[model samples]
Target: MTDQTRISVGLQFGTQPPLNTLRAFLLGARAMTLDSVMVIDHFQNVFPTSIWDRDLTWLAAQRDTPHEFFDYQVLAGYLASRVGRMRLGVGVTEAIRRHPVLIAQAMMTLSHLTARAPILGIGAGERMNLDPYGFDAAEPVSRLEEALQIIHLCFSTQGPIDFCGRHFQLHSAPMDLKPARGRVPEIWVAAHGPRMLSLAGRWGDGWYPATVVSPREYAEKLAAVRAAAVAAGRNPAAITPALHRFMVVAPSEREARAMLDTKVVRAFALMAPPSLWRQAGVDHPFGERFNPLVDFVPGRYDRETMNAAIAAVPSAVVAEGPLLWGSRNQVVARLRAFGEAGLRHVVLAPVSGLVSPRAALYSLWATGRIARSLRRTSPGDGTSAPLLC
Candidate 1:
């Protein structure tokens, strides 16, 4: 398959201190056929104090604090020096913290550093990143729409920008910076809901959803994105369909299932909102509308609170759609299914690595093998090549 038709797989990881582990992982990854490397941007981590301590003990040992998220842009610039021709991007950054102008400037600067065009993953503000710093988090989606417009204007407009919107007002704001060698950064929107999906088609060059869903459900979401793009008079196929999900791999499906039952793995279910827990006949300790991804404040919950929430997470979630895990062949088959659903790009990270040091090594090895198999096969095609394992 040609570049445009071939499947693209990327990695998403944090760039905190003790870069040796991450750099080692990337050194091994350099031999793989990865298309991109994405770093997450967040002022605060989602995990509470106790859960973080128990899971990421290595990081905890190195730092005074359990949660330490280095600035993504600074780390991305550093990473550019370490990586090869792979694309670089923040997996998803809030449009609220930094003004659109600043984000545009940062992207432009990084564009000169990387071999390929960089990506700017924009998403509506999350509470942990917003409410703590006292930034205005009200009407986040609406704010993000205005931010997208201003960012576009900053990159596309030749002269100063003069625009007014409900959230921001720019009076001839001068942003005359040009792209490095005409390589404009692509904006991939991390959209989930209907309105956010519409915004993605209207402004985004790619659609990136982190939620784990069946291939049919993914196709449905992609259809909505395409429909919205067509309504906006844009070429629907030009928008890349991407997914970001967590994984846990083992030699067999049963082993993978057992790995999923660990305390670290089960805690991931807390990332889902309470509304989802209710579907499984479980009550969220935080209440019906509580969503940790959106509303969780780091260092807020004690051990008991976290344990209560983790206990409330039914076994069904571990054996369910969101967290992808299985044997190598099963994982390849699942990814092939997603490819058939119009998934051109995917970013997966191993959640089971949090279990132990041995599990971490296996996770890296298995993930590398998975990346190789996908790159060799013609995904989205009816047939798949033999599993690499």
Candidate 2:
């Protein structure tokens, strides 16, 4: 098979910063060689929405920054206004909390506004968002599947869309929304479980697996997705496997680790849960294991537990896997390994300053250090993007 490799990149933003800040990030991300800019759709400004310490005296009192939480639709629409060609995505819009019709409508509008550069990524929402809305957490697997079907039907079907499922029932509702250029935005599913992976192959155009996954593990998952695609009578090669990598780059390993340990890990510690640590093979006193692979730091648990939970997961090990952290060459080498493993796109998590601080600074940093390295590698015989049989 011809490699036909094209590198695509995205930025993951959690909190809804000011419109200007987002605009700057989008502009900077584009300038930095980032192929896309993504915003995680959520209501909470901070993770572990439950905290016994209202003042957080345990971690040494740092003044809590007054947070402004923006609705995902508003943020995405605003973001669409500024960028011309850069791909815009929702890191994940939760299926259960959002009505499929509304979700589809919003994405279609955004796609039109951006002149057809939109990637819709959806996932099962966390308890913090779904529970308060009185949703049963146990039904996520079913809810997500049903919601996906509904969303796809709403976007792809012409005129009225009617559907009935265990979780949702849409009755022939009329929808005039049309995607700007082609069909509705490309659908990307953020998933980890076997069933979800299978669902991605069956319904998704792309898969956004997180940073904790090793290239080997990703290879296995990709294989599974391909199998699922074949079983579903879809073209296996039609699905694009993209990895989401959290990173901190510097001149040396120590400096890189320091930046990640202090900035990325620490900032997110209060939100990290036992699930995250379980994935990292770390034990916590809270009687929980953190699995960084599937855990979302914010909105998972409370601050104390979140802090203690993440402290257990070794940042170095997590970084060593799919993530590109360390010197430029080292980051490049790790990414090269993934590219060889059949990864064609990389979505970088730039948990750093606003884009004004450096327009596309992180993306530019990654492209300069990593993307350039891959370009020099010549795709090694032009067979890099294919799954090994």
Candidate with the greatest TM-score versus the true structure: 1
- lDDT (CA) for every model shown? 0.78, 0.64
lDDT of 1 by residue, 121-216 (tens): 989978888887889989999999999999889878998899899988999889988668767899999888899899989999999987645787
| Model 2 poorest 10 in a row by lDDT | 54-63
- lDDT of candidate 2 over 2-78, digit per residue (tens): 24554555667654545666666666666666567777766554434354233332222222432345787887787
Cα shift from native, residue 275, model 1 (Å): 5.5
Compared with the true structure, the alpha-carbon lDDT of candidate 1 equals 0.78
Against the true structure, what is each candidate's TM-score? 0.92, 0.81
The C-alpha stretches of model 2 lying farther than 4 A from their native spots are 1-6, 45-67, 263-281, 289-307, 315-323, 352-369, 375-389
